[model samples]
Target chain A: MSQPGPDAPSQPLRITVLTDGDTRPPGLERIEAEADVVLAHDEASLRKALPGSQVLLVTDFRTAALEAAWDAADSLAWIHAASAGVDQLMFDALVESDIPVTNAQGIFDRNIAEYVLGMILAFAKDTKQNVRYQQDRRWVHRDTETIEHKQALVVGAGSIGRRIGTLCRAVGMDVVGVARREKPGDETFSAIHAQSDLDTLLPAADYVIIAAPLTDDTQGLFDAGRFKAMSPHARLINIGRGPIVVTDDLVAALDAGEIAGAALDVFETEPLPADHALWGYDNVLISAHMAGDFVGWRDALIEQFAANLARWQRGETLFNPVSKRFGYAPSSQ
Target chain B: MSQPGPDAPSQPLRITVLTDGDTRPPGLERIEAEADVVLAHDEASLRKALPGSQVLLVTDFRTAALEAAWDAADSLAWIHAASAGVDQLMFDALVESDIPVTNAQGIFDRNIAEYVLGMILAFAKDTKQNVRYQQDRRWVHRDTETIEHKQALVVGAGSIGRRIGTLCRAVGMDVVGVARREKPGDETFSAIHAQSDLDTLLPAADYVIIAAPLTDDTQGLFDAGRFKAMSPHARLINIGRGPIVVTDDLVAALDAGEIAGAALDVFETEPLPADHALWGYDNVLISAHMAGDFVGWRDALIEQFAANLARWQRGETLFNPVSKRFGYAPSSQ
Candidate 1:
């Protein structure tokens, strides 16, 4: 971190961008102007570019090829994810290495919170039935439930989960949180319980929200036993990774009327097959994994990364650095 | 207003309920035990019951028979409407009469506010389209709009409108209200503009909610000229009376793409005929006129009246008294 002498100029920062396709990120001109920009579509290209790169910008955030190309990162100092969740980037080697990781943490918090609120309101108002009735040209009047004093249990206490809790509380819902450990809740949650208390908390929650990152401990967290612990009138909302819930168990739970309804924006499989049983249920609301993808979000994502990149170049501490062992940024950070 | 001496027993309070059908309001046992309860199914029955009644409760909230039976209300001291809006009861005779009218005001405020918020969110998230996509078994990924920082214009500054503004502000929307006069806004609206300033406000509003009651001044308020003044991307949500929005003008506006969409719970015609053209639009969301009728709402309405009746018997100031000329309870009241 030594400053260069008056006669000498530092070398340009070399950055390898691991992309899903050949196309580069939009509005990445600022980054490209001052750095050596290497776009890699796959593991072979990423490996070839990694030797001279001082930083890795993961634009293809979900690719598994980063682990394969890890051995060639001879000059890599920091790794940045263009997404909030760095689940795919937390490999055994990366977690065990001295390299620090940062993610686009705060970017998706409010957007995802809004999406969750919309889902919650949609369920409470029976909006899906209203749409169906409109299509049938039939006038059906049904009394709706209110969320004013209802309880919401947010499964994750990350930035996204906290944002969800804040908005829920703003609309008069009593929100509680589940995290790695128990703590007194802040302005968002009434109380935050340890993950171990989830079974006891599940029964009281009128709405259970999954906003955790995909991790070894979180994957398959809401299985048959967890669903059984929830109230029959409770609704399950998953904006987190799909693998976090056992799909078969959820299907069984829905079929048996063990749970009232679910609004899932993610599934274990991407682009759920047309024959999927979940698609046929009237009580289940299904959407592609797009809870946080608001219009102009790409530009916002690039802007967030640009800020972080500038901070890295200046040797200032990066924001949203991940706690590698936990696989997501801890609340304290 | 003088209290009777201990030796004088007070006569029972006679109440006439103008109903559209023979069935009386549920849980009337509490009221029937203390008073002379008359269930009138038509104008004739209401006329006969009204001669000796001191209290009149309108359960068929939209009936026009109140005006026809007005002459027989010789002993009437106060009128109570089970529904929130007192538009139907604000007849020429009633407006000039010394009798006071009370409505079920606060009972529907939060419920209607939730409904309006639900409609706003449904439009912002393209929830109707999402439901359609799910029905088709298609995994469509489209960027959605966010309500945060968006502008909302709520016409009517009564309890329901204020509640709507409060909820919209809770979700980070910039809310402005349209009322009878210009005033600095409170906790709900950023500003409350007089009705004369609506044209200037319309162009900036992302969502226009008609929460005003049906009065002479408000009837046919949203006409062709007003629609033309609105942003093309704006949505109209009417949880108030239907006649406030001219049906033909609204249809034309939607057809011409002058407005993006509408969520109409109240139509000029109830149970909006199956053959109505509004039923076929992909952008129009139609529901039976039950926005504020959450489960147990009837009980809530009855409970509200029971409390007000107790106050009336004790010669205390009645709650939710209407300004007959204005049709609904003014904010000052």
Candidate 2:
């Protein structure tokens, strides 16, 4: 693999975008005015477009066509994903290549943080049961718990988790963050503990929010044992990668009443099957994998990509560079 | 009515409580130890207990038995309501009498503030629809709006409305409060507008929260003309008295899609009848009037009363004294 020189290219750069059908990024006109744009949705289209493109914009991170067409990516110098996690693109072929990869990280932090706060307040106020009563036209007056002064244990200490901690603290909650390493606390968290302290923290937490990335150390981290360690009244919220939680163990925990409730936005499988037992639990709140999505997100992603493109043209380092081995953008970036 | 001297009472003070059956305030034993306590549920019981009683505590605000038996209240010197609004106790007899009225004001401020935040976040996140889709086990992903930097118009300047504004500001919202008189802006609100400015404010607000008391000027304030002046995408939340909004006009506005959605915790009628049309609207969220109720709210109310009882024994003015002519506790009290 040869690196591009700092000198400007003699011709316009060719940028190819891989997206699902009908998933065009907004504000592409800003990028199109300065580059040759090619939109590809399938393996055949991607392979044909990959041969001449110098930059690849993976708008649909779920597609595996990138791995299949890597052999034809002769002119590809940089890859940018329109998602926070680059796990799908970290296959053996790309990992061995020299092309630098960047991701859209900071854009989703506040949006996901707001979503988690909504779930916490919803659980504390019994909003799900309220809606159910509304549907049945039942006037049921019940007491609800308060989140003020309540403890929250965030399992991840990344940007997203920090934002969640900040929002929770703003509402008078006591926040503790768990990361792979113990560190000095910031304004958002009172203390950051090592993962080994999860068992100790679980009992004190009224809410356990998962915002950790999917890595070898985190897969299946929340099993029956961990659930059993938590307080019976504590709730679990997963806004991170789905594989970090064992779905079956969570169902068992709910069935046995080991925990009060859960709100799951992601699953081990995409579009969790219609027969999934998790959906049948009255205490569980489910949402499609959209915790970080907001209206006009596509336009925001395009703007971020365009800014990075300008830096690339000047041979400056990209903004949110991801380490292939780590599977996520480092917090420092 | 003879004015009591500033000296301690020579005899035990007679304290009568008006509450629904099986609804005694929590921690009443502490008060019972010092005073002669009488509990009354209906008009006959209230009349039997009112004679020679110096103080009345109205825990059930819906009761009109007090008005029916006002003639028997020969020795009643003061009345304390376990609610923020004193409309139920604001009969002509009490308003024109020498007896002073007080209410539970500060107790419900934080609780109601949290509830309003829950509703705002729920609407912005589309949480009610999320639960519906969850029940059907359908994973349909959709974009949701964000509440950050959104404009909120709170139509009250009381403790509860102020707290709501503070919490909304904590989550990055721009808050504008409406009161009868304009005041210097506090940290919670950017500006406090007079009632006359609502028409101009309504057009720009993304969320309009009603927390005003049930007063002559506020009754039927949110009618068809006001609703028409609001943006089509704005949402309305009512945690205040029900009569402040015309129920029929609200229904018509919602049916016509003039507003995006609403979350109504108060209604023109309590225990909103099962056949009510408001229950059928998919865009509206309905809850029983328990927004300010937390797990131990009864105990908190009793504690507040006990503190005020000490001041009464000393023949001093009570806390939270209401303006009988105004039908609510004035902010200064």
Candidate 1: where is the Cα deviation over 4 Å? A1-12, B1-11
lDDT of 1 at A225: 98
**Residue-wise C-alpha lDDT for candidate 2, range A1-333, written one tens digit per residue:** 334523537756888999986767889899999799999987899989887688899998678889887787878889999988777798888888888899998889888999999999999899999999998999999988888999989999988899899999998999999998888898989999998888888998899999998888788999999999999999999999888999999999999999999999988998889998998988999999998999988899999999999999889989998888777787861
**Predicted complexes: DockQ each:** 0.80, 0.84
Residue A192 deviation, candidate 2, in Å?
Answer: 1.1
Off by over 4 Å in 2: A5-8, B1-8
The best candidate by DockQ is: 2
* Predicted candidate 1 versus true structure: per-residue lDDT over A6-47, tens digit per residue: 112365678888888856788878888878889887889988
Cα lDDT tens digits, model 2, B1-333, are 434423436756788999986777879999899879999988999999988788899998788899999998878777889898888888898888988888999898888999999999999899999999987788999999899999999999888899899899999999999988888888888999999888988999999999998888899999999999888999999999899999999999998888998999999999999999999998899989989999999999999998988888777779998887767776651
For model 1 the local lDDT of residue A235 reads 97
RMSD of each: 2.9, 1.7
Give the DockQ (C-alpha) for candidate 2: 0.84
